[model samples]
Each structure stands twice: as C-alpha cells, then as structure tokens.
Target: MTRNTLEQEYDIVVIGGGTAGPMAAIKAKERNRDLRVLLVDKANVKRSGAISMGMDGLNNA
Candidate 1:
C-alpha cells in the first residue's frame, strides 16, 4: 500500500465529501476569503454520497 502525508497549514479541515461537506467548505470560504480550507474524502465529491445520483432529492435526506 502507498502512504501519503499532508503537511500544509490549513485554517479548517472538513472531513467527508458528502452532501453537507461541500456546503460547509463554501460557507467557510465565504466567511473568510483568506482562510485555507481542505476537503478530504475517500471518493470523488461530485459522484459520491447521496448526491452521487444528483441533487434532485436532497430535501429528503
């Protein structure tokens, strides 16, 4: 297996690229444009979580 290490400084680190992860990241940036944000996930944010299919049924979740 391969190993990876992240040594950069970040103001915020959001785990889970799921339904709410993206929103949180966006809001953080909006609050402070100079903030360093990182979104980590095991899968692609676009095609992962409940949104994998689309944002059509987001209210249901």
Candidate 2:
C-alpha cells in the first residue's frame, strides 16, 4: 500500500460529522464565503450518523 500526506490550512476546522457538525460548517461558509472551512469526521459523513442510521430506519420502518 502507498501512503500519502496532505497539508492544508483552514480558518475554521469543525470536527465530527454528526448532526451539528455539518450545520456549523455550512453556517460558517454562509457567513463568510472567503473563509476556509474544513469538516472532518471519523467515518463517511453521508452514511455515518445517528440521523442517517437510526432515525432514518426508524422513520421509514
């Protein structure tokens, strides 16, 4: 396997892909389009969260 390194600079770094994390990142960008915002999550943001996994299934079921 090959390893890669990434270097980035951001004015705002929001951790966690859970519920509020994405919202916060969106709001920050809305407020300042020029600002650098980074959103980091342990798992895939789209499929990893209580709302996506639990609530979605519960509602559909």
Candidate 3:
C-alpha cells in the first residue's frame, strides 16, 4: 500500500457495503461473470447498515 494509492485496479469497487453495494456487486457480476468486484466501507459491512444503530427503518417497514 502507498500513501498516494487511491487505487490501481478493479473491475468495480463499491463503497458502503449496504443494500446497494451488495446488489450492485451482484448485478455487476451477473453482467460480466469475469469481473472482479469489491465491496468496502469504514463501517462493519458484515452487519447491515442503519439497522445496526437500533433503528429499524427496514425491519417490517
């Protein structure tokens, strides 16, 4: 890694692995089966966003 490394390569790099990122990655993958997809964010992406803050905006909404 380098201090100036914004990025070097990637077919697609999505920030904020929320509902959109995952869906985008999935769609991009479907569009090009050979593409390399990356989902990244400062927050814990493994856990769904918004809902993690004790806000059930999507929970049965």
lDDT of every model, 2 decimals:
0.71, 0.71, 0.62
Residue 18 in model 2: shift from native, Å? 1.1
Q: In TM-score terms, which candidate is top?
A: 2
Worst 10 residues of 3 by lDDT: 52-61
Per-residue lDDT tens digits for candidate 3, residues 1-61, read: 6576475678899776545656677788889999987767566633566444553342212
Q: 18-55, model 1: which lDDT tens digit per residue? A: 67876788789899999998877666545666564566
For model 2, how does the per-residue alpha-carbon lDDT over 28-53 read when each residue is reduced to its tens digit? 98999999988776776447755646
Query: What would the TM-scores of all predictions be?
Result: 0.69, 0.70, 0.57
Deviation (Å) of 25 in candidate 1 = 0.5
Count: clashes, candidate 1: 0
Model 3 whole-model lDDT (C-alpha atoms): 0.62
Over the full model, what C-alpha lDDT does candidate 1 score relative to the true structure? Answer: 0.71
lDDT at position 21, candidate 1? 73
Question: Clash number for every model?
Answer: 0, 0, 0
